[model samples]
Target: MAALTTDSAKTDPLIRITDLTFIYPGSVKPVLRQLNLDFHQGERVGIMAPNGSGKTTLFYLLMGLLKPDSGTIEIFGKPVRSEKEFENIRKRIGMLFQDSDDQLFSPTVLEDVAFGPLNLGKKPAEAKLIARDTLNQLGLEGFENRVTHKLSGGEKRLVSLATVLAMEPEVLLLDEPSNGLDEETKTRLITHLSDLDLSYMIISHDHDFLYELAQSNYTMKNGQLEPMERMHIHYHSHPHTSHRH
Candidate 1:
């Protein structure tokens, strides 16, 4: 299938994948086949697919965690083919892992959130301040010194997001962000993400969440992305009537 381009493709995209193909070692078939995508700045894109459809693999390829067997990947208008090139890309694009436990490792919430900024060369004090502000932005102001492992699932998810936001990334790649959240927590997450200005691409199975957050939606089929219409829900009011006996 031909890859679909966004309407704003005339402008340079933040990330571009052209004819990308990948195959696992010793596998008889390619997991991804001639995939093409263009992600522009300030766009909220959602991707939905069944398990083992190469959705997460696509994300890994974008971040240079996995190399493509064929085709090219360009970020910020430059071709990326090496880890050294991907280092800068990683700084600009933050990824929120599907599992919060895989993301947070520091003993304290502040430390986990500040780790990215520190690696980016910010002073310890400055990194802490960034962490605090990120937490505050997420309505987690008092969680600075909380024990990382002791936090609830929702809190950990928010803190994991805080760790990514602390680096001030231009784009975010969120994997199943609403996976384990309660309805209330999911609502909170939706509100918080709606208020952010950054561009993001979310991979999720929750159509409701995607409809709420994504401006553009796509479905992954046979290792390719095809544009899809957003799902909409309508409401109706019913009136009760008394029956005479």
Candidate 2:
């Protein structure tokens, strides 16, 4: 896929990517090609695309999981030019991966949620307090000692988000948050996400979830990002519509 660029508003943008391109270690071609986009603070942006449309790749780039070949990625007005800069920016960005199993691998749910803060040098007790509070906020009170591996699919997904929330990141990156959730759980997830104050970028195939949680939309096709039209229907009406713009 060839890379492309689009113009962003002249106002201050929270993220800036200029001519970014990246190819996997052993792959012959780059997954993202000269991609450029700017996201503003406090915006709930939905990234919609078919499978392998570079949606996940874009998230990885923003999260510092993967480095770009020859472009600049700036976060919060700071340029990410090296691993150290990326590490610093990572502390301000929370991420929920596509697979719950990939994220929740600790012995207990509390341990998993505390991992981020612990790595940042907080005391064990303080980290536990943060984790417990986050879980309580998500209606998972009194489940701190629960074993992570024993959780159900939906439970694991919620636990994953709880872990990220404990970090109190300024930017939230969620990939396929509704993948394995039941209808009730999905509704609760939407409610929780809508109440968060952080800026967020989400990659999802479920249009209903996007409509309820996202104020703006973008799509990736052949390694390029195209801005999608803003949708303005009452999302609470049908609760299951997948209509796109």
The best candidate by lDDT is 1
Query: Can you write out model 1's per-residue Cα lDDT over 76-134, one digit (the tens) per residue?
Result: 99999999999999999999999999999999999999999999999999999999999
TM-score of 1: 0.91
Shift in Å, residue 12, candidate 2: 2.7
Ten-residue region with minimum lDDT total, candidate 1 = 231-240
* TM-score versus the correct structure, for each prediction: 0.91, 0.88
| Candidate lDDT (C-alpha), each | 0.91, 0.86
Q: Count the backbone clashes (under 3 Å) in each candidate.
A: 0, 1
Give a tens-digit lDDT track for model 2, residues 44-103. Answer: 889888897788988888878787888988888777877788888888898899999999
> Candidate 1 — which pairs collide?
none
In model 1, the Cα lDDT at residue 244 comes to 19
Q: What CA root-mean-square deviation does each model show from the true structure? A: 5.5, 5.0
Q: Residue 48 in model 2: shift from native, Å? A: 0.6
Relative to the true structure, candidate 2 reaches a TM of 0.88
Candidate number of the best TM-score: 1
